[model samples]
Target: MNETHRSSTDSSEASHTEDGLSGSFEANEDVEKALLPHMDIKSGPQNIGKETSWLKLCSRWPFLVTFLNISLFIASFTLWLWPAPLRHPFKTQDYWKETSFYSPILERFDIPKISRVTNGTLYDTNPPSVLRQRIGKEADKEWHRIGDHVWPLVIGEADVKQLGKDPRVAVKIPEDLGYGSDAYIAQTEVFHHLHCLDMLRREVSYEHCHQQDISQCLIMTMVTQSTPPTPQTDLKTVVEARTREWHFHIYFLLQSPTETAAALALRDAVLRLRRDGAFVAVPLFRVNEFPIGPHPAGSYEIWVPDSSFSDVFFYLAANRGNLSVLVHPLTSSQRRDHETRNAWMGTPWPIYLDSLPSDGDVPLQYPELGLGWSTSPEQEISLEERLRRGAKVEALLANDPEAAPAPED
Candidate 1:
């Protein structure tokens, strides 16, 4: 009877346990059904917890959400508005614009430097020669120093005094010009000629008429002693001569102020023209203080090539101020070149034709630094006596102190 009681009690406990498990499962289903509408399709237990925490934080500090949104908006707008150039802040435009280059071995003590930023445009405004120097290419050496070589077109005695000790130019103050040394201070042909005429007028007045009656004397002289009409020469057939080279002898009186000034001015003009590359071949300008060979009076020589003959000839014709220019050709016969094969600009002066050699080969001699003539004017040989003379010239020039060095590439 005790064993039957125990078995019934066990059966009752087992039925109760089954009923409790079934009830708990039903309660869990009800809870899930209630929460189904609030949960997202992708939500998991961890994700739902995170979303709930985020919502709680936003509710507690409303300004935090606004600040975050505004910060995001500003950052996006700034990124959009940023220039394209600044997008790649660390990138270089070219190899020349290396922003971070260091060479400890090459420049151990040098301060770190960054190349300038360029936008593929030419911003260099320096002169070509200066620019060349900056890039390590040597600038060209001028034929002569312009400042030291050239004289002014016209300058006063006071101004001349200011320019101390320049030997290339010849300066003089006209003496006994009656109008006192200070009164007449012109260094041009026009003014000098006027001064000469005035002196002659004074002399004529002293000899013939009183100083008060000089004006009437001059008028009478002009009317009575009028020059005869010039005889017109017939236009002859122009023949192109067999010429090698040409010389433009700019004749000036050494002591005369006007002629010397004009000559100096001409020299300056020629040098400037050459500097501008106006001549085909650079002409040599040499001042002859003493009369040499066939050239009378103080003269300067412009040794020009056949190619540059016409340009130089026309230039002298237009610009030879109150002075004489003997444009002569170089031919086989030296005497004929001076006397016969010559043209004159302004008043023709008498050449010492007897002094010139009658028959001889006249080889052209260009200036030592003359362009377009010789690759090496020193080593260059003339057609005649080149073996002895040319070698000596080359040696002399090579050893000369003033010779320009070859330009660097």
Candidate 2:
């Protein structure tokens, strides 16, 4: 209250501050504004808590805040690192994106097809979506066109390379609500490609790991070229402008499920295909690599049969008891006379007989329609002539050089 006391107090505060020991200095309004940190924070109508100090949790427990941030980072990293499947009652956009990884050969077409000899009744609809999920990027909308109630089909690219294996890539799912594998197959047709690309007919079994897996669909691609070549060949030789020694064959397989329910789903799909006049289509492969045999049983050969189709069917049944096709009449037979035209027509896999029977057991000697094979022409050699040349060369090679006539005695 007195002048001496006020002077003493002010002097003492100054001395304490100067000595770096003042904890009770009078903080002025402008003094707070002069702070180096948070100086830019202006006091205005926009600044609701002007002059009020902010107490952050980090200031209380810095380590705990740091641990929480690290946990968030780890969680984010885990989501990015491990691509896992999600379960939703209904499919999501992400589900569509993830399912788009697998694709199909052909998506949409108008022609009716039969999958196997004994699938079931015939109907006109689409195949399931699972098949479209197999081909990956190859089955996108830009590369394919699907018809209503039909399945999506791709306009296959002629990749001289990248044969013999399925390349996994991003595939776009159709935005349409009904877009799926059944619709893809029903609607799609390989523009220039036969059901089969002659890549080789191998039984690439599928295990539907999912609940709706279609393991029973009778899937087959019947490729035929009359002295024509199949695609998917290496350019063995380019004589000139003509593609020579081309390759061709059909592809077929029976995919099933790991669980019995999945198996039934597959069987039902086959029955649907048989009933729908649409042959179930799945991943295709090559015949040479097929485990069944190097040569289709004469009875099994759709091209040249050794016995009645019933015998062939029964024989196939006996050997492949696990392999089941719908044993019923379907619209495919009604719309298309199956056995009359193609021996393997009704079945998912139709066997091909080499054109050059004279050559015996050599599929190479036959003139095949090229599927996805690369080719250049040395000169155009007729298929028959090519066979003759190949046969002569084979005969000469088969001869025993050591058995040549010895010098006459």
Best by TM-score: 1
Q: What is the TM-score of each candidate against the true structure?
A: 0.31, 0.19
Per-residue lDDT of candidate 2, residues 1-409 (tens digit): 2344445545654565566654444643333444322453333323434323334543558878788999999999776544233212323443332222222321221223446553332231266332223344433331233212233443222221222211122143454745653221212234334233312112333554432222222222222232222332222322221221211122333222333343334334434543564431221122223323223321111221111224334533443333333222112122121222223323454432211121122232222422111222543356668658866766676667764542232
lDDT of 2: 0.33
> What CA RMSD would you report for each candidate?
32.8, 26.1
- lDDT string for model 1 (12-110, tens) is 545655667656765556445434434322334566588889999879687887889999999998876565446744333322222222122222233
Off by over 4 Å in 1: 1-241, 281-285, 367-409
Please give the lDDT score at residue 16 for candidate 1. Answer: 56
Q: What is the lDDT of residue 78 in candidate 2?
A: 78
After superposing candidate 2, which stretches have Cα over 4 Å from the reference? 1-61, 81-233, 236-409
